[model samples]
Target chain A: MTVADVLLLALGAIAVGSGALVVTSTHLVRSGFYLVVSLGAIAGLYLVLGAELVAWVQVLVYVGAVVVLLLFAVMLTRAPIGPSADLDRPALPAAVIGAGVGLGLTALFVDAFRWTRFPSPDPGTAERLGEQIFGAWVLPFEVLSILLLSALVGAIVLSRPDIGARKAEDA
Target chain B: MPLWLDLLIRVAAVMAGFLVLPLVIGQAEHKVMAHMQGRVGPMYAGAFHGWAQLIADGVKFVQKEDITPRDADRTVFRLAPIVALFPYLVVILTIPLGPGLVAQSLDIGLFLVLAVLGIGVVAVLMSAWASANKYSLLGGVRGAAQLLAYELPLVLAAASVAMAAGTLSLPGIVEAWRPWWLIWQAPAAFIFFIAGLAEIRRPPFDMPIADSELVFGYMTEYTGLRFAFFLLAEYVGIVVIAALTTVLFLGGWHGPFEEQLGWLWTLLKIFALSFVIIWFRVSYPRLREDQLQRLCWLILVPLALAQLVLTAAVKSLL
Candidate 1:
């Protein structure tokens, strides 16, 4: 195998392995942090696959902002930070489910393709992605903006303390 | 050299250089501060101003029992420092130091640098939370929020420069300068450099890791060499950010009659900028979190966008 193949495989392994840790880690805050790692590693794999802009947005939005907010929410709520919560519950079934999905996805991808084909584009990839995003995919881009606005409003609502004590009093 | 060979050498040099630079610069900063304050700095440690300090630090870190607190989450705790230092290493790769001095001058140099540097946020958050420390966790959350507020203006300010210069390629942008881009985009570029300092969590904007508030924030639980690594990363980070500013706003390697000086001109320019960064750290009092956020979003963002328009209009007129 080429060194590129080895490095890419290693990165993939790190993403999947640590992603499981993100779910299983007993400390709720740390779990959110690991989610950033999983997302970032996925971004890195995107880079290796030559999707530089997507990799950056993954770092920017997912790792940089979403996980930060997750940690913020985790901080506000008093989750058990210690061995007070049990860590090991039912990993055997989780392992089975995880492996089955992986195999199923692999089968689907393998079955769908007769031969692999990819378009070669010059770098300055952010600009290239910009052209595609604003040109052919402009409708989806506009829709994505709406989705982002909704998510932002939802987050602000959930974070609002005024809504909480007032609603409790109303109840 | 072949590309593979070149890559290997550059990687080794960066890794080895990063390992040692902190101790050297730490000593230098100490000595300079001491001179400024009228005192002798470390007169000992290998018969001088602590020349072997980083080596001793490295040895201590290697020997220290890697600790995961009883209450701490194991997986994330182990991974945080690695993630923190990795991107710091990755950023120095895109410097485009000179004709032969860069590893790979990827076209999206500035954005890639910003993205890599931004990912360091995750490492800080993980380290803080995984430690299971109250202070560290608070620090992490504050830092995250602070990052969001500052990052928008930082990018906008950078975009203003990119608009004025009309290229995202670091080397190409540098070559476009007739005088200096700094002279042309003085208003925007100055804002960009100052905002860059805040982006890196330097003093005056270091709300998340404030020593007085969070007691070293995410680093509260760390001790000895592991903490040393964090400190090293901070200093190296200062250099990296400064180098980026040098490349983007300043005329990178360009200078008056610099042909004879060769690589010396670029090094000098970058080092001069680095000294200014150090000067700011020594001079400024830290800003509060809200103040930092307001300055970036409410002020700098508008300022940069306006400058971007002004620049484009001027280009069209001239």
Candidate 2:
């Protein structure tokens, strides 16, 4: 394998490891935090693929919004930040599942494609992405806006306390 | 230089830039403020100006204690800086300094840069939240609100430019503009630049990390070089956004003298834009958080919408 291939594989492995740790961790807060490593590395993989728009969207949506929201939820709920949570119980099963899935994915990737040397894209990826977004992906683009608007409204709704007083009056 | 060596040189150049530019900005800020107030801010740091201020600060930060709050989520707290500093490297990777001079000119450079730029916001949120201090938490909350509000207009403005330019690659965007898009669509350019400034968290719209209310906000508890790291990241961000602004709207490395001294023109434009950022810092007092929110929603958003319409109308007519 080429050096770049090796590097990508190593980084991908690291990403999967961290992501598994994120989900499998007992502490809800640390799990949210570990999601950053998982997501950022995946974005790095996206960068490697020449899909700059997809890569950035991965960062923008997952790192910037989703992970932050997860952390906020953890913090607000307090997630019982303490030593008493079940930290070790899930590790064994998760490790097994993770290893199996990792091997499976890597095998599939290696087996499926006739890999060739792809010349790296010349710069101005964002501009090209914008063009594609408007031209080919215009439907998804508009739908994404609608989705984001809904998410914003839902997040605002969910985050606020009921107060109970306003609910009764409205009812 | 060999290919590897050339790569090293570019990395070093960007690192040196990341390291030095903030110090220069600090000195310039001091000098400017001193001139305004009829007093010299720093006369003793070095020969011409207090040029060695960031250097001195860096050494001090390193020498100083790295404190972690006793109750903090130490892992995430530590992860925060890495997350914060990582984007700069990714952004600089795509940045074309001179003719054929970018470190790695990936085709998707603009997308990579903007994506990385968008990602940096999270570190601020994470830092503030993980600190567990009330002010830090509040700052993170404000940052989340501020980022979501402005991101759409920022993307829309950029997309409008991309529509006119007909490219997604940064270098392509530059090449597409035989005459700068700024002249054809000054209104779009204006909206994008202003929104980009807000996105970068420069005052007067820097509500997320408001200094007065939150006491340095997200990086409050971070001490020593870690705090220095955060500040360095901020200035680097200012440079990147300004560079993007120049590339997209200013016709990148396409000036009269640029053919001869390409880096010079790029830096001159970038440095000029940076001055405006610093100038805003000097002149205007920070906007109220709610006011910052309202300004984006009511003013800039409407302006961007109008620009999009104007652009579409002109394209159809032409």
Candidate 3:
């Protein structure tokens, strides 16, 4: 195998290994940290796949913002930092479901592709991605903005119960 | 020069730069802050304006006890400072000190810099969690909140610059403004500077490590060389942010007589920006966490979005 193949294997192993740790680790915060490692390895996979923009964006959004937010929520709620006895639940169901899904996806993917090699595509440069995003995907992009806007409003409403009470009294 | 030899020379230069630049900037910060506060700073360390103050500080840190609290997570606590400092070194590799001087001029250099720099938040959070102190945990939580609040605007502001330049490569962006720089993109530049300050957790946005209240916050339990690493990372961060601002807003290595003296111009601009950071520290009082969050979410984020839209419109029109 070439260097790229070796690197991909290493990164895939890291992603899968850390993903396992994320679920199995008893420490809640440590699980979140392990999630970072998993996500970061996925970003590395993207980098090796020659999607530089996507890779960095993955790092920026997933590892940087989402996981940070996850940790923040955990800390705010005073989640157990150490191993908690209650975290241990019967693992048989989860294991069976996980294995089934993993095997099903693998079989489906293998059947569909069947080791066919595709021609190398153009590098996904930022400029090209911007064009695709703003050109063909503009409608969905704008819709996503509205979705985020409504989510923001919903979050505010949920957080501040007094606002609803004030509106009810006015009505 | 051969490709490998060229790579070796650049790596060596970057390593040397990393070692020396932090000391110079740290001493500058001390002298400037002291002079601003009407006090002499470290007069005896070097005997010539305390030139050796950072060196003295480094020696002291090395000699001090490396303490780990009994309750601390040994592995994460030990690794945290390395995590904190490593990104600064990596980010430096992509920054263009002068034309043809960058260690690796990737097409996505700017994005890579921002992405790697974001790792600092993870490092800080890790350290705080590992310390197992209430203060450190609070500081880490504050850092997470601050990062979430400010990072959007920071990226948006930088996006506006990239939009105007029509490129994401640092050198390409620099060359785009050959005639004039993107400081003309004034609102975006201002947003970038402010968000960058928050990103680095400098004074006025330094709620994370609010020394007065949190007792150095996430760094409360750290000692010796580990503590020194955290401090060094902060100074290195200042220099990185300042250098980035110089490249993005001011012209990178662009001045009169620039061909021969491009690196000099770059240094001058970086140090000038560093002085502004130091000035902010000396002059502005720290903001409350709520106020900092409000400023970011309510004001800066929208302003940055508007700036991005404006840049897009202007770019298309031009």
Candidate 2 per-residue lDDT, tens place, A1-171, comes to 886687689779979899887766777667776788799888878767756667778987788777877776665556444343655565677778978998999899888875866777764255576678899999999999999999988887667657444776899
Residue pairs with colliding backbones in model 3 are none
Q: Provide the clashing-pair count of each candidate structure.
A: 0, 15, 0
Each candidate's fnat, listed in order, reads 0.58, 0.51, 0.60
Better of 2 and 3 by DockQ: 3
Query: For model 1, what is the alpha-carbon lDDT of residue A17?
Result: 84
Model 3 Cα shift for residue B196 (angstroms)? 1.0
DockQ of each: 0.47, 0.39, 0.68
Best by lDDT: 3
Cα-based lDDT at residue A119, candidate 3: 83
B1-318, model 3: which lDDT tens digit per residue? 899998899899888888888888899989999999999888889789888999999999999999999988787889899999999999888888788778889898989988988888998899988898999999999998898788888888888888888899999888886444454578878888899899889998899999999998899999999999999999888889998888888888898887888889999999999899999999999999889988988999899988888888877888
Q: Report the lDDT tens digits of candidate 2 across residue range B1-318.
A: 688888888889878876676666666766776777788777766666677766676788999999988877787677788788878867877878777767777665665666677777778777876786777877777776777677767877877777676666777777776673566778777777777878778887777778788887778789987887787777777887788888878877888877678788888888888888788777898888888788888988888888888767766776
Q: Flag regions of model 1 displaced more than 4 Å.
A: A1-27, A82-124, A137-171, B2-4, B38-40, B46-68, B257-262, B315-318
Error of 3 at A31 (Å): 0.8
Mark the 10 consecutive residues where model 2 chain B has the least summed lDDT: B106-115
Error of 3 at A150 (Å): 2.9
Candidate 2 residues lying further than 4 Å off, grouped into runs, are A1-12, A47-52, A73-171, B178-180, B316-318
* Worst 10 contiguous positions by lDDT, candidate 3 chain A: A79-88
Report the C-alpha displacement of residue A8, candidate 2, in angstroms.
5.5
How do the candidates score on chain B by TM-score? 0.90, 0.93, 0.97
Error (Å) of candidate 2 at residue B152 is 2.1
